[model samples]
Target chain A: MSTSQGLRAWLLTEEPTSRRQARMAAWYKGWLTLRSNTLAMLGLMVLVVLLLAAIFAPLLATHDPFAQDLGQRLLAPGEGGHLLGTDSLGRDIYSRLLYGARISIYIVALVVMVAPVVGLIVGTVAGYAGGWIDVLLMRMTDIFLAFPRLILALAFVAALGAGIENAVLAISLTAWPPYARIARAETLTIRNSDYIHAIRLQGAGPLRIVTQHIWPLCISSLVIRVTLDMAGIILTAAGLGFLGLGAQPPSPEWGAMISEGRKYILDSWWVATIPGIAIFSISLAFNLLGDGLRDVLDPKEGQS
Target chain B: MSAIDIRNLTVWFGHGADRADAVRDVSFEVADGESFGLVGESGSGKSTILRAIAGLVPTWSGQMTVAGETLGPKRSKSFYRKVQMVFQDPYASLHPRHTVDRVLSEAMQLHGVRDIDTRIGRLLDDVGLGPGFRFRYPHQLSGGQRQRVAIARALACDPAIVLLDEPTSALDVSVQAEILNLLTDLRQEHKLTYVMVSHDLGVVGHLCERIGVMQEGRFVEVLSVEAMRRQQAEAPYTRHLLESSINSIR
Candidate 1:
């Protein structure tokens, strides 16, 4: 109780003791605002559950997700120790859903890591350097943007050979164009700000100006944008998986599971419908979380 | 030698059909430890002169020298070490995400200054802000306080020439006097050369020893503060400017 009180005091302190403390307090304040938002909290809770389920999948699954008992095929939900039921192959739906969370998260993590960073560097450099450089980078971004996201991802995946890694790489290559556009837009505005000019007066070169001065301002907007893009990223990955271009058979990937269950979907709806529901719920969770993050992180709202 | 020298400085934007001259062949010199002011109406290019000196704008032809070093198309790191600029808007001048400590420390680090921890403490104190304010973000401070932090950041490099781009124009009238007084004290203490730009005649007069009146991108007159005070301006435009300034005050 005393420790909790001490932590609360520290978070609320106007005078922070160190740089770390100050940064933490600023972040804690953002968390406090986020906590007050109910829908955001709900979205955060769902994501937390998804993360936990992925981590504890082996321990939590009552049966091996890959084990196929042909006799038990097409069992309804809650029949014979299968809580969510069995797929057409008799693999437990409940256990597969738990493990599938890892694939979805992994793809999301990898795509998120690759796309926005590439976008940020490209956008900031193009925006700050301006002139021929701006024309060159932005034109390149425009070319990438001209392609439909899924079609581009599909084309890349087809060439790279079918697998989850190829799917992630494809999505990352397609996803970065929007981020670059956003970062470039944000950078164009930020580069003209007085703080940037002041930094330049300190003899900071274009690289330092873009990375240190301009990037910090651009990040808040980019973070909000990246969060909002998560749902689209998830859907794109799922589309690849459903098309049999991602996560090979028996991997229990949610989309692939849905693809396999499609044959039995008409007779026993739970097979495909269950994994479809899982995908829908996770996508909805991401949308909600992104909206909540937008409220907290949007610089235009003066929260920053 | 003068601390700052500019000969036949011509600054413009765009080219051909879209050309616009901001400062045209303007020549001026500021002696060591002198406080020079550029006063003009908006769009008269008072701030452009400072921007040219600080190397913020590239489309310029000029012979510019500061602290015994000549300026070229590109500014050297050592040039930045000897010169720094405080922007007009305090709110806009500070990095919103960075704390006051970070802003000050970054400026020092750029100049390769050591013993930062102690220097930051002293800088904050010098700007009349206490040590407790160091960790606070710009949003956490008032406009006046943010300006103080900006001033402190400029001082962090210990530049011999500190350019003031209408430092107090965005501040409250109540806070403006305090900031002006602080600028005066710091100038005397550091023996720094200043080239300040402002539209407010009273403000320019308060800080600068000599004031240049600009009209239509050219200097109409350069007069001492005493001459301005005595209304002894030789140029017809200078007299009109003084009259408008007095009328505005009245």
Candidate 2:
């Protein structure tokens, strides 16, 4: 009884100074909570470094990413003016690393941005509507999942032909199924929740229940999934580039640089090594960041 | 006139091999400004009756009319506007991600309410939550506070009939009393009609003017609090329930 009185007193206490003050408090709390995760902070630092490198590639690189000097071809690190040596086409490995960051960063940003919106819409509709709609939509998602991811992406790229746009499309198509599956599961869990039922009872429509109530609650998991998928997307783009299906020759994509320099592995190890390291570092960073985010955003973990 | 009227309602779930009827041959009426209680154990279709009325459980065939309009295959906005529901778990009934403001505002927005902020403010105040709580998320509030917010959200559209499915069952005993008091106060203040489904006869006795005892998807007896206290149960099933509860408590 005393506990209940104390709770009531707390609830009825004087209001916050203002809405802005309340918002600032919430923001500060979130930031403080997020900052506690060391691994997430490290991942964030790596992401920032990659993003900075991608944004200022022109300023950071002395030699042009695309320019080739045939005489300098197959040069090892510390040879002539090439810092990280030269690819098979004689493009500077340092400059290509900088430029390749642009492709990786762009693909990650675009895929994460596009896939979630589509998946959230489709999954929310299917899960919230239930019955025949749910059955039809889930079956469609299953069909997309039936094919192995890389093969399906390869098939899509094959159909759309090679280019950045086709690559983005392939990744987008392959990526949304996971989001759809996750969002569907989330919606299924939340749809039966009391708040959702309460919202429905208030005469709020199906769309409102999904967009306002369901989506916001599920967004944290969706965000973590998107971040994890970033690593896979970068890897897939590189794989395609290796197969000569992404970023045509001399374009200086990381995988293309590796493919072009693979023959010189014994002598000019730096040619493929630098770009390979960049890919590994960036993908690893995103995975770690995603894991950290999952820990932080989870309510059970957040409270502790 | 009846605020909510239902006749011969039946609800079924699953299909073919898994199919089974969950609610069968149920009928009741709640008069305007009256509180009617439906008491039943788990799986007795009490909650399903509420869901059927709310249009969440659409697999049911029933004659359900709220505010004199006949309910149909698709739920109309008007039907929702008049009849709303408060669910079992306060913890789950309010979306954890939404602020109390957004939770209330979204409902008003869907109903195309004008002057949303004022309406929301008034609702928050009506539910006894201070203005500060309006901006706080569900996690920030206590269970009772959250339930209050849930009640406020329900009252946003000035719904005439509110279907309450075990609203206080999730709270502590003392907290349950407080919520029950709040609910009773709100019902009286709004002149609202209530169709509360609960297993607690004491709660029903405290709040409801009429009580219906359900078993196996059917009402075994519908009686007033006076009838219940007098131990004047008409049906064998209601007598068994009353006897069992009495025996357990003793």
Candidate 3:
């Protein structure tokens, strides 16, 4: 290489020593923690596979999930060109299971992303401001928390009419209260700290303090809660889909597939059983990931 | 013009019956480039006076000003740009998560001050820290180092007056001397005014030209450091406190 080219390459590769050190430390810590947690690794592996399968369902699926095959209805498992058998409607059970993962991803993403952002903003404002704002916001969160999750979701879906969007909305509405409570508690502790007082004295406004200091501290706990909530969110989505409150027929949803197969659960078995296992495994993986994250993020929280 | 002027400053907490005065009917003035200290024991309202000036103590009835401008109920950014405070506990005053760079940069950023890199480097150098310490987190710093960072942050806004609330009480005697010396040098170098609140006669003695001895939310005596050092306090309480403080050092 020319000297000028070599100099350019060297400049491009160079990083500040502190930044490089911090990144390496983080990367090594993550590697060490992941190596230690066998169950989490397995769970992560399962999630990766499910994610890829969902993404590549069009390519991975042996047959179309929606195509009716009445001529070959009730094909048993291990039958020629049919794997995990065909359903009562002669839809490919394996293909539906693969496609069902897409629905689960949507619900999980909404619950984990939307709920925390809204909750963090609301709770931090209430906690930092305190007094009447605290009372008003906390009371609203408490009222939402008083009802059981599924019942509130059911009420919301009932009121809004059935659809994937409405079910997500219902879940998101109910899910935020727990996060609000968590973020509020975290913000209260942070608001009273001496540094916060110092910054207030220096004329740092409420907006800067909340977004920079309060939000970052509260996020670790919020993330842990979100990870743990994923299982419930998936189940809630599945329940909504089963009750015809989420993605309706012609779309391959795990819960809807299970609901449709319930009549022939004993006759064909693969129809409902495969989708049931899919739900169970994904829920189990999310729980594992949540547990692992808590330990990795804060050792004390993990211990408690 | 006076750097800080407070007349009939009174502060209270809670409603009737539960209501208690923290600082009662206090008045003082520290002139431009002058260092005035309020010395008192715990619960003597000196800290409250300082907090009130910083706008931290919300319930107050007072007329206060900085650099000849009367302070309004709502403190403006312009007002903040004229006054800043250095807190007591260095460890707690510097944010645990923020780096020294962030801590100093924020003060400048708030006032829409540009040339952040040059300013940060200058402030760090003023605090006796080099450029390498900028990105290091507060946890990575020593107690004295953290206080220097806090001092740098306070100075970043180019405030005319600094309120020091027992700035050295949280440090060791040896480290305290270093911080005091740094404060003295910085005050001279920048021509900054100060209103420091402390219980230690020796501490305030190092910085103040005039020291107010306070007790139970009232000023027992407002005398020069030279008078305090010369055992010339007219009030019996001031004499007793000074005598005891002098005896303790031996």
Candidate 4:
């Protein structure tokens, strides 16, 4: 929050007693910041609305997204029961967009949850382990990083089946290297600190020191990086879906919805434009949310 | 059994010609409850000897006996609690993230000592700090106050022996005497054994009953506090040290 210049160090200590209270204070501070940031608040509100729309899709959609009326095909806006109009087969565009949120939300959930954990483990271990282990692990990370991200994801998805899970797995494969590098650098900084040595002398084993001392200190950076990476992950997932390598058709995935509407772009613009807008808003929301989180998570960076 | 006994202890660092012996073939014994001071100039290996005993230095070959028990490469938790260390820089020594309360209580908790709050409060009082300083972080305290907290931490385990690594060197000169005085009072009150390292001969003279003048990884001579204070050091190196030490004072 604006009231504090920086975080106190003791909140990061291994003590279990003060931790919950301090973390609650930190979150309260972060919420205060979130409230002050108008754009982030707007982004949060948009995200919440999208989520609610997705959950209530069954109730909100007047017609099934898949059920098509060939007779009323390509109906214009404000015509019949179709409020925003219909697609080539006369399917409701609004219904499809709401359902598309589920696919986007699922892919993002999977990628963000899995990628950073993979990276944090690999990086911190390699950094803390040092010597040949560090050399071997980091070089492996470098090898993965040498390839272009999208190309690597495409290759992995191609090798696996062309499905949403495959795309998520592929995205994860390309996503973890940078996180590993971040985690490794953070671990190196923490490993040499005098506090680590002090803990070691206090009869704390390596595991104790890493989990209690190193992980907590490194988590703030990892969280900021991971949150910021969400937009890119979503874009990549959409790219896969557009290429027919993600969620199959009839599932109402945003990218697939766009791809389906591509041929009718000249005659009916709303079909593709509506889904495209959905993707754009979600990505913007993630970026805005990320910027807000970075402020609260690392207040020192915000100040300087 | 002596508080500490080392037989031909040798600690080295690096490899080949780059290899340097920090404490080489050095043998010494500190009696129970005796305040032993290792007085030497910088890079003279006094601190290295302290580190070797503290188990901070990984590679060392020798027989080390503490309170009748033989020590191995890895000292046990019980052994760690039995012998604690106070590092040179008070600012550098304590964990900045941990409050004085946690710093004092963590070791006791590890050793399964109950009554943590009372012990912590008493430890604060023992170091000339108050209960108000308990939750304060290291940076929140002044140099002297932090050093007091460090001393309190070292004494928290009811340790039989304490290692002092230039404990007052990092403090302001005005605060140095107060810390030294606190340390002296704590040692006497607890009847604790001390193996303190200091480059300043006078500081050691005031704190230690017997002082060892270490040079080039070995003790040139060990003299009584009375002999050192009376300027009756025997070895030529000891006399040379005394002269420079006195000259610095002048």
Candidate 5:
């Protein structure tokens, strides 16, 4: 038979009754291939633990995070009821770490959520629109990127005046440009895709094409980029708090605790060490999760 | 009345030192439901003419009317609903991330098609794909299957006209014939007008009612398949091309 005839026959042929089950079996086999990646499994585990810790912190911690006892100040780890020892202010270190996690996790989640939404809107419009709109939006993004992110964020914080809300606003504004750039690049690529053109040819408007075709395809990359950005936001928020520009004292911010503990580092290593470890662990968890998600979510990567 | 009418169409790209006219002062007419083929070598502007008609290449200056509606500088959604395009590379034409169902449903949804699942299922079956294949992504299918899916996508809006840009050039010859037959069947079934651009004369002869040979942005010769086969084309360029194709077959 000729090649076309063979293809027609193959396309037309009805499979046996068990073929559907076999296809499902093959799909599961592919899923199992992904599940077998050791690093991804470990990353997922770490992410779940950190998420649970952040979610159930109040129930998990023994003491009120903000409550203080002057007599308990500087008590070392394992001394009486001060399990992780007391900070310089005699605040319970363990409770503060738990509450500090609340701040760090909240900032990361909020920044990640808000930044990508802004980015998706800006990037999809700019990239898919192309021509003058693309040029104007991209140049604006370039201007944002030209300034060092931290300094730009610092200026925004200064303008807004220092506080948790201002710090979040500052970070979010600075952070969105990266997601915009990623979304724009991905949008540019997706706009040229046949499915998008096909939709356009089918009398779909620009908004429909972008929302239905371009957005869904670019979402995996966006999700991965947002996951990675979560780590950076956490670190940046902590840094701002450390510099006393965010989350004022006694709010149990990890960076504030570390900053307050710095002067007595030699006398009470536990104060800085506990929150520092928390920051390190949470950031590491996000980084690992982002990497695993990048691998798994990419259809091309997963296939291989 | 003609289903498509074009007069004095010229399409240019870039400006100043880099300016190039991709399609220049080309004109053609296709009677309603007629299968018209545009044939040429690469860079011969056959594809550009189709693009201009389909409203893809908006930088062209032209008088193009499809189904009696005057073509405009920018395409409208309603214009697209009437005329659609199928590109050469099936691989690049379909989004790999979407399942066959999503790919097919988008156009229907855009057109506010009611009872989308029934339409999609019927379309899949019409394109010779089983119901089981509807949920599979493009990458899961082979080249010919993807091309069939592309065809189904073009047909989804129930377009009266389709601009086929070398629709089978990327496929194996045998698969090309299948697509040609599928296109032929679809045109007859829907009474659709086709403006297909192709370099392969054999495939065009097999499918199109009339063929216009394009060269250097102009229609050098327009002939029926019977005229082409009977006269054996005495034009030097056409003769040369025929000779080369015959030699290749030998």
Candidate 6:
């Protein structure tokens, strides 16, 4: 308790002794704002629980996720040793759900990593290096924006063949255009700012200006945007999985499990209903977190 | 030798259909250690000339020689090393995210200044700020404090010429006098040359030895502060400007 109190006092100090303290103070201030928001805190807690479930899936599962028994097919919830009952193939529903969390987290991780970086580079370059470069990159982004996200992803997945990696790749391609647009808009404004001109007068080159100066300003808004878009990315991944273009059969992916349970949906609702609830909760959690993050991270929303 | 020499400098904006010359065929020179001021009304292109000299505005045709080196389509790294600029708005000049130390250190490091930790402390002290101000972000500082940090950043490279674009215009009037006095002391201590652009003749008169009165993209006359004070100006526009400045002060 004393250590935490000391840390809080340090973070709230008006005079920081080092750069690290200042950075931590800023982050702590943001955390404080986020904590004040009850709904956002709830969403954060849900995501934390999801993450823990994904990490400890092996220890938490009652049975092997893939092990099958035709005799015990379609058991209801709280029956026998199974916690959430069994799926169509008698694979434990509770265990499959736990394993499925890992795949969902992996997809989110990959898409988050791949999409935003590609968008940031392309957007900052296009925005900072204007004229023909701007025209060229923006037109490319326009073309990407022209296509419906799912249809485009479907095309990429169909051509690349069905797999989780291909689904992530396809989603990343579709996801980047909006980030590029946001970054470009941000860059256009930031490039003309007095701070930028001040840096340029310091003998800093265009490369330095775009990478060091402009990117830092652009990243906060981009981060807010990325969080807001997380729901869509997850939904797109699930859509691909539902169509059998993601995390092939026997992988226990939530969407693919739902696809398998579609036949049993009329009688045994738990087979499909449970996984659908999982997807809904996760997506809703991201959306709530994104909204809260915008309140904290968006400079426009900040006090002058 | 002149610290800055400009020959037939013409700066414009937009393409053929919408071509508007912001500064046309303007020329001037400031000798070493001289403080020159440009004063005019809004949209009179006083700041445009300074932007052109700094190579911030690329759409200009001129011969700008700074610190004995001729400026071309691009300003060399040494040009930046020799010349630095303090912008008009302190609120907009410093990066919102960067701390005062980061702002000062980045400037010195860009020019390869060694022993940055000590230099930053000294720079802050030189600008009348304590070492405690080092780790605070721009938002944490007041307008006067931010302007002081901006001044410190400009002095980081020890440039021979410092361009002031209405440096204290955005500041409170009380803070303005403190900053102007600070600039005066910094100039004398460093033996620096200044090319300042401002609409407030009182400010220009306070810090500058010679004031150039401009009108509609043209220099009406370049008169010394003595000539301006004595009301012995050359152009009718100068007399009019002088009358207005005195009127505003009254």
| TM-score of every candidate relative to the true structure | 0.98, 0.90, 0.88, 0.83, 0.90, 0.98
Q: Which candidate is the best by DockQ?
A: 6
Cα displacement (angstroms), candidate 1, residue A265, comes to 2.2
Ranking, lDDT, top scorer first: 6, 1, 3, 2, 4, 5
All candidates: TM-score of chain A: 0.96, 0.90, 0.88, 0.88, 0.86, 0.97
Residue runs of model 4 more than 4 Å from their true location after superposition: A1-23, A26-86, A146-160, A264-270, A288-304, B90-105, B115-118, B128-149, B233-250
TM-score of chain A, model number 3 = 0.88
lDDT (tens digit, per residue) of candidate 1 on A120-226: 99999998888999999999998988888778767877698889998898788878988898888998888888998888888777878888888887888788788
RMSD (Cα, Å) for all candidates, in order, is 1.3, 5.0, 4.4, 4.8, 6.0, 1.2
Q: By how many angstroms RMSD does model 6 differ from the true structure?
A: 1.2
Count clashes in each candidate, considering only residues at least 3 apart in sequence or on different chains: 0, 3, 0, 0, 1, 0
- Between candidates 4 and 5, the one scoring higher on DockQ is 5
CAPRI level of candidate 6: medium
**Top lDDT prediction, candidate number:** 6
Model 6 misplaced stretches (Cα beyond 4 Å): A301-304
Candidate 1: list runs displaced more than 4 Å: none
Off by over 4 Å in 2: A1-28, A79-81, A147-161, A299-304, B15-19, B244-250
What's model 3's overall lDDT? Answer: 0.83
Query: CA lDDT of A243 in candidate 6?
Result: 90
Model 2: per-residue Cα lDDT over A176-231, one tens digit each = 87889899988898888777767766666677678877887678889988888788
**How much is B41 displaced in model 4, in angstroms?**
3.6
- What is the C-alpha RMSD, rounded to one decimal, of candidate 4? 4.8
Cα misplacement distance, residue A124 of candidate 2 (Å) = 2.8
The segments of candidate 3 whose C-alpha lies over 4 angstroms from its true place after superposition are A1-42, A70-83, A146-160, A266-269, A295-304
* Candidate 2 chain A: worst-modelled 10 consecutive residues by lDDT: A9-18
**Candidate 2 structure lDDT:** 0.82
Candidate 5 lDDT, tens digit per residue, A84-133? 99987788888788777778877877787787888888899999999999
The model with the greater DockQ, 1 or 6, is: 6
Worst 10 residues of 3 chain A by lDDT: A8-17
Q: For residues B1-250, what per-residue lDDT tens digits would candidate 1 score against the true structure?
A: 7999999899999999999999998999999999999999999999999998898899999799889999899889999999999999998888888889899998888899999999999999999999999899888899999999999999998989999999999999999999999999999999999999999999999999999899988999999999999999999998998999999999
